[model samples]
Target chain A: MFGLETGFGEFFTNYQYPVMIIIGLTLIYLGIAKKMEPLLLVPIGLGVILVNLPWPGEGLMAYEVLNSSTGLLETIPYQDYVQPPYNMAGGEPVGLMSRIFHYGLSWEIMPPLIFLGLGALTDFGPVIANPKTLLLGAGAQFGVYFAMIVAFGLGAAGLGWFDFQMGEAASIGIIGGADGPTTIFVTNRLAPTILGATAVAAYSYMALVPIIQPPIIKLFTSKKQRQIYMKPQLRAVSNREKIIFPLMATIIIILLVPASAPLVGSFMLGNLLLVSGVTDRLSITAGGGFMNVLTILLGVAVGAQMSGFIFLQQKTLGIFALGLVAFMAATAFGVILAQIMNLFSKTKINPMIGAAGVSAVPMASRVVQRMGQKENPRNFLLMHAMGPNIAGVIGTAVAAGVFISMIG
Target chain B: MAEEIIEAPMVGKIIEVMAKVGEKIAEGDVVCTLESMKMENPLVSPIDGTVKEIKVAAGDTVQAGAEIAVIE
Candidate 1:
């Protein structure tokens, strides 16, 4: 009686749900077969499937009402649950992913925690040894600004593609960062509605970094520039220098960009644990258990945001299209700027390394290494590429801080 | 005189040992290199001395402040 009405009857009303389920299956297929960030895509794909299933409005993935004063999650009244604008804020969550998103993501705790783990795992020595790579990282952020301006312009022109507000533009722009945690953090704050599309786009593009970066790198650099060799030996950093670097960087960067304090603070704390050498247990925990748990929660929450009605939009398609351009633009800008730097500097760097400045971590750097080796077997650019690769991570966080400072 | 021991400066794997037992080395010489988070950190001698013992070998994981070598 109640079951068929909720299942078959409800399914007939919105044909989009079935289609979304197919899309979810496609994500699962791609994750399993293509190995495209399976850790994230698998959970996200399952989340999509779970949320899209036909159920009563107050069922599992739907927003259940909460009493603010009593601090209890309550069932939403049938009328309110079925009405438009189902996402009422300022309530405790009953659903698992909702609670995770509300407490972890909305409160801005999970992303920084993820960054802490990343910091604990990251090697900053390459960036320290080659300071100039920081500029390449900064240059790669041109795509973020470029994408924002373009998004805002399209919205202003009323082109039917999208009409993004300032916050929405900022959220969309961060897809260029190619850093998943930072993108989600920024989107959660700026435009929660588009969080699913933006996160999916960001992660999807990040997974495709090897596919996305090489063409842009080739477009920007000549074969000679790609094959240019720089010595791989890095000056050994001392323990004192390593210990001092994170502290100094956090202090100086936060002073300059106060808004980045949360992200940079957590990141530096993780780095401190690693470099201080006195906190092996804490470092291992941060890098291993903590990161894994947070990644799962974050992935599921992001996928849960892809509820059928929210994700099936022309604007969603636009976000995906623009995301690709943003990633390519970031990669191109980094390579082109590296070529420009070569004109003024005595020691020329392999321009292939510049494409690694997109914060996709070792993937972007590995692409550079592979491409370099393909050109010349003697070339080992992984460490060299890592400098800019790691620099891109910091640069993206700094950009997010700047955006939050100006727009939030 | 106080006995001296070279301690690991950070948590990492001992990738290479730069000093050998019974070898005389000056202050600031690298005793061993530790690889952590994909970057190499060099453990240095605080005082000039002959290496008395090598406490850790290549491929061994070490904790920060753990004794890696002894010099006297």
Candidate 2:
């Protein structure tokens, strides 16, 4: 009775905003129920739940919530209905989760750790297979640059909504590269302030690749082009060639764009285990335990920031919308570029492989294989797409390098 | 007179030669096979061409974009 008033205890005991709780719960539902990138979304839902509850651990519990948004779900633990600071004589406040949101997300330790995890999980196999696909990856980066200009224009036009300095805008714009890691890397360096928004934009867009890319691809490819029968070429890459690839890549990419070394290094290291053939144990470990752990950690770390305050901005919405556009533009751009190459070359490129030009790696390649089968069931586009799929990875890395050198 | 020459897309050992020097073919006809990535890829002719030469026999590794045959 003396220590805990029912109202104060009530505010401290439960979620203040039922809608927000449901939103957090909704993420969990999507992650688990619908299976939309569950590896990331599940942890995010848990983080959302943790950050929203009324507790000292939430950082901003010191503030009073007379009529805040979270007050909607204020749970009561005691028998006494002693009202809050407004109604009672001198009761404590109801801003527990608000405080947590302030400290946990806005403070900036989480997103970078997420990046570290993203770095640890990545593989450079696709990039290594087709080094020339790097250019297509770079070409796809046109979305980043284009988005930056748009961000800058919006900033000047009074939509100064995002804390987006030119550097921050550039970082945010990298979502167009269809590269989550690079966006994290760039934003973490240039515009640390917008880390949460940028991360959300990247992950969300990545999850939507299948939906976003197909429409864009269909728009660019006609029935004839889609049905064009390009006989598959078998690539006989030697163990020696595969082993030497990571080393040659490290040398060339590092020399050409030193800034990419960190991401390129770790990514290639993961792939090296896979291709070296001498370390089955190591390959399995990297591809399994190491990869899974990083993915889980990355999801949680990213979700750690999506609490109510910062995520509610109009710019956040803008980033999501623009990221979608960028993804499409990149896919289409890669396909058209490949089509142009087809015009000049004796050998025809399966335009379906062009869709893999975005650096989502095996995911994009898998998408290509599925679509290629849809058009022609006998056509196995996975390995062929792997050439450009991996190329896209290198391309994105090189683009990241160019961005970092100019702006880092 | 043949106007086409087929080439390798990657460096690999020619595990099998399916076509002969005078074989007439259509587009995407398997002219030779290169074993790479542990799969035998039919070095298909890009167009209707006569196999002018069997450049390499079994156990030969050719570089990427190397000419495997010519057709005209």
Candidate 3:
């Protein structure tokens, strides 16, 4: 249908697709050259490219789908899919990624499975040995609520030029947790429309943990506070204790926050497999084999959701900016809470370890360790930092539960 | 000579056994590695001593406080 009369030149009219392709290339470059969460980034980067391509073909991303009733193959109209009538349920997926995304993400299957793998790989001993770190985890969750209010304020006041509803606000707020799966799970449930932008913001900030946390932690802590030493050796936890922990934690979390049960349940089940000592094959598969495969699928599916028209909105930029604020606020709250804890306690805790409670797991904890070592060479805070680090995972999940319960 | 019994700190399968009968070892030397919670935790010698006996082999499951080795 494209002769001079039909104007094939209209294909090149909107140049945003080219700009999005360059953005995709930048993400791939960052993953490969910068080594920034490459496991998630590489697949997501490729998906961005696939979804941005303008030309349509069979099995290609953005492929033409047959309108079943009319029996005519039609291109995906951005207007049809961008707003409330997503047509996800009605349309047949014409691309591989579209099919995967339809079944995996929209169905809400991927995030919980990823959490299961994370649980199998996690060590809860550090958290158990130091229960007080649970407060640091809880304290860090302040960022989520704080960001929610900020987003609400922006939308209500019309200052930030974005109108986020309650669900979208709650979803945007979760970026502070620094736990990608929990963020995805909450966003998927609460704000499916903004999932792509929010997921990208959450993961990007997580990858930038090493860069983002140090300055914030340093700003809040003095040299003397940073140099505080924590004992490397943790009291040995018994097998019976380890065996009972997952069940106990699950029961307590479910009883207290029923909404959090899905995420906490998946995570604790994985930990149970690891700690039970009877499920070796299951543990190995959950931690190693299955986890790797799921990461690729989750990354690609999430990336594919970010089609140029949907992702290039002014609201997406607002979400990214607010997401950074939430992250910084979460880190600040964790450290400040630790400093407050020092006032009442006899055995001093390193305030720097408090910063690890942002739930990026070992990355945030490692930053604390490095910062502690810089201030006091003899200070070994890695083990201590892990206590709050793991607790932050639970804290973020609980926070997501709270949001879901109140808002969703 | 006095004998000391080194016990398992947690219930886990032994993935590695570094202790040997009649081998002299320093304090803090790892005697074996245990797999627990998906992490490999090493059981270290509490005191410098000569390894008198190893009670478990690699792949053996042991409970907390179960004797792993006897050092003299």
Best by TM-score: 1
Relative to the true structure, candidate 3 reaches a TM of 0.81
The TM-score-based order of candidates, best leading, equals 1, 3, 2
For each candidate, the alpha-carbon lDDT, in order, equals 0.82, 0.63, 0.82
lDDT for predicted candidate 2 compared with the true structure: 0.63
lDDT of 3 by residue, A91-189 (tens): 666678877777787777888788899999888887888889989988898988899899988998886446888888888888999988888889988
DockQ of 3: 0.06
Mind giving the per-residue lDDT tens digits that candidate 1 earns over A1-408? 654454666766787678878888989998999999999999888877767766643244545765555666666522243234443665446666667777888899999999999999888888888899988888889988888888888888887777788888888888998999999988988888888899999999999998888888998888888888666466676888888889998999899999888898889899999989999899999999999999899887787778777788799988998888888888988888898899999999998888888999988987887788667544557778888888898889998999998898
Better of 2 and 3 by lDDT: 3
lDDT of 2 by residue, A193-256 (tens): 4566777677667777777888777887876677666544554457777778777877888998
Clashing pairs in 1: none
Worst 10 residues of 3 chain A by lDDT: A1-10
Q: Find the candidate with the highest DockQ and give its number.
A: 2
Report how far residue A59 has shifted in candidate 2, in Å. 3.0
